[model samples]
Target chain A: MGGSFTVNHLIYLLQGMMWTVVLSALAFALGGVAGFGVMLMRTARTRLLRQISFVYVQLIQGTPLLIVLFVVYFGLGVVGIELPPLLAAGVSLMVYSSAFLGEIWRGCVEAVPRTQWEASECLALTRWQTLVDVILPQAARIATPPTVGFLVQVMKSTSLASVVGFVELTRAAQVVNNSLFTPFLVFGIAGVLYFALCYPLSRWSRSLERKLNVGRRQAA
Target chain B: MKYNFDFASLQEYWPEFLRGALMTLEMTVIACVFGLVIGVLCAIGRRGKRKWLATLCGAYVEIVRNTPYLIQIFFIFFGLASAGLKLPIFAAAVLTMVFNVGAYTAEIVRAGMDTIHPGQIEAAEALGLSTPQIYWDVILRPSLERVYPSLSGQFVLMMLSSSVTSQISAEELTGVANSVQSESFRSFETFIVVAVLYFGMAMMLKFAFHLFGQAIFPRRRRLGTPL
Candidate 1:
């Protein structure tokens, strides 16, 4: 009834923003490491390995992130692990992000072209060296735009962590709204903050995409 | 680790589960239909003669695409309530989904539209096709046929994202799962069931879209080939 929108509310939101950044960084770092293994497994010479990795991607890409969060948060408790909400959310996001990043990097590797693989083989380079020296560097350039775009998805998805009681931006807004009953002002500012964080990345992604298209056209 | 998992407590909640699943399906279908219309219109808006219309549509797409669905839902559900324009929860959820998916569909549809060769439109005109006739027979139908796979993929994603509506307590599958889990204290089991149900729903959606594509584009169906 009294003034629900106050300076204190804004500060609380800023604190929530910090957690959003922290969670995003954590998921990226962990997901990146795991995704590397998945990417390698996907491209390895063995059909069995590639098949397994493909199944992993399908399983993840088929399901919702919210279910993954719930499974990790609640499923772990059933197994006698009473972890904090942050830890649970982190683990779930890492798993979720890994599947997507794996698929993305797989495309990047395959896009390096068959000729590059054969040429590297002609050099008598070992499988590891060829991939490490030649394939990855080329794939990296192609990967930049999609990878950056996926980061936007990662950041937006941190909102899901709030469902597990991890107090990030969206959750903070919900909390403030409960107290203030001024849902519009509270949620609108939260949405604007999310837009502020995401809009630049979206622009960068589109620009990168355009530049890459130009590069491809010139090559053609 | 020793474990005992039971789904028995959730068994009696079948009615709620079914109701929620139907609601989820309804929400998805409603959103997908309206979203596709909005998307195609926006795609045309972006490509047609007016610069301002293109800019306006571009802004709408970017704003919706950049933000999270949860935030969008909150804005429509809670933001509108504060403005004293409260709709029913289901309507609010559907409206949010329509807005959210419309932007994404616009981008995809625009990509489809881009793949239309300039020669095709000219050929249609050469045949004495009216502007509306040319747009329908030449531009829209073929472009949609070419991008049907991507459009279907987007719809699957939309159905998956519909799970977020549970946050607003809209009686969807996830919302029902939440209630059942709390009542049964079988949180893990309940989620596992809901997850599997969602996977099933996704497959069903894909199959339905495939059939729909076949029925709508009978030429492609007769050829047994996608556009």
Candidate 2:
């Protein structure tokens, strides 16, 4: 309690920030793949596939992310499966991000004009071929900003991993604050670090939207 | 590889979960009311002619938007205590939520305001409407109506996030589940029940908002148009 805020605490926070980025990267990579599968199922030709994916999305979205974390961490601990905090946090975030990313990408894919699908169909291309060649390429442009924005969200959410004993940025701050007894300084610095990470992405998303929208406006 | 599940052990704690859910609902309702009041003022300020006022509002919105809600809660609940401005757990949770949702609501309402044609404001002024009258009738009402769906959706999201307040032991739904799980040793079962309750609450709020919207915006309801 007598220790003052020092360079050591800052170094610890930076390391925690590093883990936040790592966890966010891991979640985004895994979630992106699973989200792609979800998007495909959502837009699938079969009604059952669409319905199943729709309910999955709804279930995940309707619940709190924190509860999802709890279920993965403490809830699963009841079973024989023992997960490290890092793995538990990563998996829950993956599940959370996948549902959201799937929905966002689905919207982008559907935004691709109906005529593009028909045009590809007229060319005697297979459905998979049309999707890979024509649909996804176009959808990628619209998805870029939101996907980047979601990256920020993923990073911010990694803070909650601290609850599961993961030593990410927020958790690190809490640890430092506990020892130093300076909650305002510790958390304020943590907030600044978060801003440094996220503000760029937010600005980038905004500018990308403007740039993309401007091009379409000029074309029209 | 087999584990026995016992949800029945938690039946005695029904009152705890019920109280927690009610507490969450009460916090959300308070947050909604105060958040909208703050949000409207901030939105109007940001778009107004006063440069400093607009900048201040913009900064508030951006800072809250950029940070994690968990840290914000910690800062408000624990951080402020160090500065000797101690608040009750309930007050701190509700305050942080109001601060959090106000920023989001400001952006949404601002977007709605941007969509209103300028001619409508001028026409309202010409009809002998005073400044407050013009804003209430021609600006805020329509903007709020237009953004009602997004506003309600944000509010529902707020309801779910109220679970985070349980960390400070506000004894909301998640907090109740935490206590019950430790007591009953049925962690998975406790959270399973809690998640379903959250889902139900979300649906209920959405339905309530829809009815409220219909009552308020009869024009949209009668026209069969989406907001």
DockQ of each: 0.70, 0.76
Residues A1-220 of candidate 2 have per-residue lDDT tens digits of: 7689889899999999999989999999999999999999999999999999999898888899999999888767877789999999999999999999999999999999999999999999999999999999999999998998898889888888999899999999999988888888899999999999999989999899889999889989
* TM-score, cand. 2: 0.96
> For residue A51, what is the lDDT in candidate 2?
100
Task: Score residue A17 of candidate 2 by CA lDDT.
Answer: 94
Q: Name the candidate that leads on DockQ.
A: 2
Give the TM-scores of the predictions, in the order they appear: 0.94, 0.96
Give the poorly placed runs of model 2, Cα more than 4 Å off. Answer: B125-128, B221-227
Write candidate 1's Cα lDDT for A1-220 as tens digits: 5565989999999889889889989998999999999999999889999999988877777778999899999999999999898889889889888999998999999998899989999999999999999999999989999999999999999999889899999899889988888877888899888888888998899899899989999999
lDDT of 2 by residue, B148-216 (tens): 888999999999999998888888999999999888878888998999899899989999999999998
lDDT of 1 by residue, B83-157 (tens): 899899999999999999999999988988887888888888898999889877788988888788889999999
State what share of the real interface contacts each candidate retains: 0.72, 0.70
| Poorly placed runs, candidate 1 (over 4 Å) | B122-128, B218-227
lDDT of 1 at B16: 88
